[model samples]
Target chain A: MNEWLLIFFMAAVTYLPRYLPFALAGKIRLPQTLERALDYVPIAVLTAIIAQASMIRQGELDFSLTNYHALAALAAFLVAIIWRNLLLTIVVGLVCFTALRLLV
Target chain B: MRSPLFMMGRCFPETYLMNYRTRQFWLGALETLPLILAAFPFGIVFGALANSNGLTFAITAGMSSMVFAGASQFIAITLLANGTALPVIVLTVFIINLRQMLYSANLMHHVAHWPRFVRAVLAFWLTDETFATVSDRINRHPEEPGLRWFYLGSALFMYSFWLFSTILGYTLGSQIPGLSDWGLDVAMIVALVGIVTPALKLRADWACAAVAFISSLLTFDWPQQSGLLFSSILAICVGMLLSRSGKTNE
Candidate 1:
């Protein structure tokens, strides 16, 4: 019961951010300041997720050279920047992480 | 072999030819096909993880269709695995999804002319992949006649692909022991990096990314992974300040 409720709540929470603006498109104009803040949301959110997922080890901050995820992510970042190809980046990242896992 | 009108579609024409809506719709799906494939692993992994995390297959697939955001769904599943309270999970997932408002805002101008039902469907279908795909199209070809259809094509393709893949992953998880422990979730991080790195082209974008990265690291010990939320909000404020000071803009 509780889990289903949570799912429904989540559905509502996620939907409003997406559906409301489109539903209210011509009726309401967002403030300029708010618009500017919203612009940074995606990049900021992605960075936080990537940083936490890669840099943290077993619930602690692991900044050392042995953090395989961090290293693989760094390599993937560079590949993405240079090649600007998603497939190539994913391929390089998976291979790099697997090798680093074995060697490290 | 193609006619001049078809060739002209490749250019940045203000309006698509009368019959080009269907073409653009297919084109949009084709453009997003690679992204859809990249997401397959994550969808499967999400299912496996959800299974290990104690969610029924029904709930897992249900959440995939209802919540419809991969990253937030993962976060929720992890929180559930940790035995976190329901309210906490809901709030965290909600905050994580607040970024969709930015996506919706960016797309508002292009979709304003669409009907209410169209807007509702498109909004429900919105995801990072669809938003990225559709936003790129809108930016490049603002006046394209069949833009809505193109957005729908990309959204539908990603939506159905994700739903079916989640089911497949759930089935595999039940059959294979310790499937979630295989560390296949690393592909998700790789896909996310692929998404974020390309957007780091502008100075403001880099500033936001840097602040978010550092703050998340600093707050890594926060309970319930609230650190991510803190870091994201802090980074948004910093980015806003930087934009206000006129130091970074593209």
Candidate 2:
């Protein structure tokens, strides 16, 4: 597809999901099961994005000691879980990753 | 169901003029300021990535303005610029955006009474930040008048900040030395941590997150980033099962 057309197509597709629920909300009540499912959507999406972005290297899975990004992310995850501070967790994780990358 | 006009009037009661104005100002400022600060680095990194991946500045900025979705747009640009198959780029963008379906479903009931034009405008700003802020406000003050205006104010502020930052990033992409080298890539992860950490308040939520993290780690090598999809599904299933079991006991 042409670039402009492609952009428009993607934009339309993206907007539909965002706009549809509000438009049809009262006409149909969502199922309890579905509502429960919705609660987990953010975590699921974020987890997926983070995994793809951080855990994999060069289209391969690498979890050894050499994977600085994974290690830093792991540290960040632990800090986030323990301290519950977003800024601190991110800063520590990024700093560790950058330091490891620079040194190794 | 309440008529659109009635709903609009009720939400913007004439009696609470002073309180409404004060709330609007605070909401706009509070919502805009943090998002602008948060989006600056993201926009810069996005611009730099687009440029490095051989996308024109116009296309890069246009995507930011038009698509207005950070994650899907980022995935689309990165994969497409890398000469990934068109089908793959489209599929990835679709998958990344699938969460919007739930957001739309949840928000539709609240905004159903608004006019189509208003809905269209609001649709443009139905981002994660806007949705989270507005939904929290609505849940807290469902009957407040001028609710749509408050939401619009917040959305407009975020929209402008995102646009401005994208332009700045695009213009300074190559000229600015070490911007890309500054480990800005981790900003997305940082932003996620900020957003998710707050939601890990319940045992079920914590369990879901733990399962997600561990499963993704185990399947991190899945092709075409399928590990994420698998981990998310697994996490949701675990969370659902746990929640259901708890309810059954009650």
Clashing pairs in 2: A21-B104, A21-B105, A21-B108, A22-B108, B11-B145, B11-B146, B12-B145, B12-B146
Estimate the overall C-alpha local distance difference test score of candidate 2.
Answer: 0.71
Task: Give me the displacement of residue B198 in model 2, in angstroms.
Answer: 2.4
Supply DockQ values for each candidate.
0.63, 0.41
Docking quality class, candidate 1: medium
Model 2, stretches more than 4 Å misplaced? A62-104, B1-22, B25-36, B84-88, B113-115, B132-150, B177-181, B218-227, B248-250
Every candidate's lDDT: 0.80, 0.71
The candidate scoring highest on lDDT is 1
Write model 2 residue lDDT over B98-207, tens digit each, in one string: 66665666576677788877887788778876766666566557787776777777787777778887778777877886676565656556556655666676677778
Clashes by residue pair, model 1: none
Real interface contacts reproduced by model 1, as a fraction: 0.79
For model 2 the local lDDT of residue A61 reads 71
